[model samples]
Target: MKKSSLILASAGALLLMAGVYLAFFVAPDTVVRIDDRELVQFSQKIFYFHVPVAETSFVFLVLGGLFGAMFLGTRKRSYEQMSYAAVEVGFIFVLLVMITGVLWTRAAWNVWWEWEPRLTTFLVLTLMYSGYFVLRSSVQEESAKARFGAIFSIIAAVNVPLTFVAGRLDSLKPVHPKVFTLQGASMEGPMLAAFLVSMFGMLLFATSLYIMRLDLLRAREDIEYLKEELEVG
Candidate 1:
């Protein structure tokens, strides 16, 4: 690994551990009214990680779309590779978001699943990107694969706002928090600090993964080119 990448990965790991420690130990517990009784539920600890993961997924989603558009406009292999790598990273984060969200909901709502707007839209987006991979694999020609992948990624990016809006449309009775802004956040001091720390760590982690994956893909291309040249010689 490159020195910078290694440092980033290490820092991200440390921050993640520290954030976890703060969330479970130092952060104040949330007191909620349950049937007219105020109760402190330890399960609220999941919020520290869940929201950060979800937000990171959004960052990757935008990057993937932007790179996809660049690839389509320039018809460059490097841009296409970047776009694909971004989507791969986004997919991983989105999966984390879904899993963590499910865990949070199960703890808070006491059910495994619900057809809530946000949840449903997120699942659909996940499926769409899963199909994006399938579409790429089914194509025999590289140009066709890149073109289709770029278009699909752009379309998927357009859907991100819809997913977010769906979540907020039911704000009056939203199961999820309406806003995560720090200025007027419902999350108090220590809890908010823990969440911010985790978010920063997760973003760093995602960036490191994206860079590492892009380097690996470039190396693989170099190897493939060498083999072709040797064969021709």
Candidate 2:
């Protein structure tokens, strides 16, 4: 592992632990009043992790798209490798978002799944990115594969914003909670602090993974090049 990635991974791990501690111990439980009765919602604690993972996924996906564009513009193999690595890391976070979301839904809504606007759109986004890998694998030529993959990555990244806004649209009537608005975050200070910690931790961790993946991809390319040279000799 690269030194920078190692440092990031270590810091990420420490911050994640601190975030968990703050979320459960320091942050106040959500309180809701119903018929003059107060109820504490422990399930709200999942917000600290769920929202962070979702945001991290979006960041990585966008980076993937940006790198993909760079690859297409310059025809640089390095950019292609970065794009692929970012997407792979982003995909893993997307899966985590889905899993954590389902768990949060089950805890808060008493149901395993819902056809809400946000959830539905996110599912579609997941499927779309999954097809990216399929597209890459189907193409035999290296340049053509990268070209198609870059296009698909860009298209999939565009969907990220749509999925984010799907929950906010008035027409959709989404059940997903809106924590942030033009005014500010709905969370109190401690909750926000915990969330921020977790968010940064998740981002750093994802970045480290991307760097590691990029290293692996470059190593594989070098191996292939050496093999080709040996065969030619």
Candidate 3:
């Protein structure tokens, strides 16, 4: 592993651990009243991790698209590698978002799934990105594969913002909880602090993964090139 990536990974892991500790122990539990009874929602603690992962996924996906645009403009293999790596890392976080979301939903809504606007839009986003890998593999030529993949990455990244705002759209009337608004975050001091720590941790962790994956892709390409040269010799 690269020194930079190693440092990022270690820092991210420590911050995430601290965030978890703060979320479970330092932050106050959400108390809701139902039928004259006060209930402490323990599952609400998942918010620190869930929201951070979801936002980190957005950041990576947007970076993938930006790198894709750069690759297209410059025709650089490095940018193409970066685009692919970011998307791969982003997709893993997307899956994590879905799994954590499902658990959150089950805890809050008493159901495994819901066809709410936010959830539905995110699911579509997931399916769209899944096709990115399929599109890459279907192409035979290397340049063509890269070009197509870049285009798909850009398109998929466009969906990220739409998915984010789906919950706020008046037409959608989404059931998903909204934590942030034009005013500010809906959470208190300690809760917000924990969430911020988790968010930064997740972003750093995702970036480290992207760098590692990009290095691996470059290594694989080098190996392939060496094999070709040896055969030619």
Candidate 4:
């Protein structure tokens, strides 16, 4: 591993820890009054991580789509590998988002799952990328597999915006709120600070993970090439 990557990973870890601490101890507690009763839901803290992970996942999914397009255009194995790595990372983060989302839903809405627009579309997005891996594996030829994966990824990215807006547009009330905005009064200062720190931390962590995974994949490809050369010799 490169020293720079290690440093970056460490920084990410530290920032995440700080964000967690601030979320738990420093951010103002949210108290919602229901029927003249004040309800303090600490589960709201999940927002710090959940929203960040979701945003990160979307960003990486877009990167995967872009790299996939590049691979299709240039027929470069490097771009293909990059696209795969980005999708893999995005999938993992999306899973994290799902888990946290479920927890938040249970806490806020008293349901483990719902057939709401956002959740449904998000699940579809997950399945689409999951199918990308399946399609890649089912094919025997490397060139053919890469081509299919690239095309599939590009097509799947069409759902990104839809998934993002589904909750906002749903008539059936969703537990997920549209908290993100440019308006200065939307969130408290400490809460915003914690959210921003968590986001930056997750971005750094995702970048480090992508670089490390790409390097590992490249190493495996090199080893396979060497083995083939030896056999040919």
Candidate 4 steric clashes: 0
Worst 10 residues of 3 by lDDT: 175-184
| Model 2 pairs in collision | none
Query: What lDDT tens digits, residue by residue, belong to model 1 across residues 82-115?
Result: 9988999999988987898788668877887766
Write candidate 4's Cα lDDT for 153-186 as tens digits: 8888876787667656757664555333325574
* lDDT (CA) per prediction: 0.84, 0.86, 0.86, 0.84
Kindly state the number of residue pairs that clash in model 1. Answer: 0
True-vs-predicted CA distance for residue 180, candidate 4, Å:
13
* Model 3 agreement with the true structure over 59-82: per-residue lDDT tens digits: 888999999999999999999999
- Global CA lDDT of candidate 1, please? 0.84
Tell me the tens digit of each residue's lDDT in model 2 across 196-218: 99999998888888889999999
**In candidate 1, what residue range of length 10 has the lowest lDDT sum?**
174-183
What CA RMSD would you report for each candidate? 3.1, 2.5, 2.6, 2.8
In model 4, where do residues sit more than 4 Å from their true spots? Answer: 163-184
Off by over 4 Å in 3: 163-185
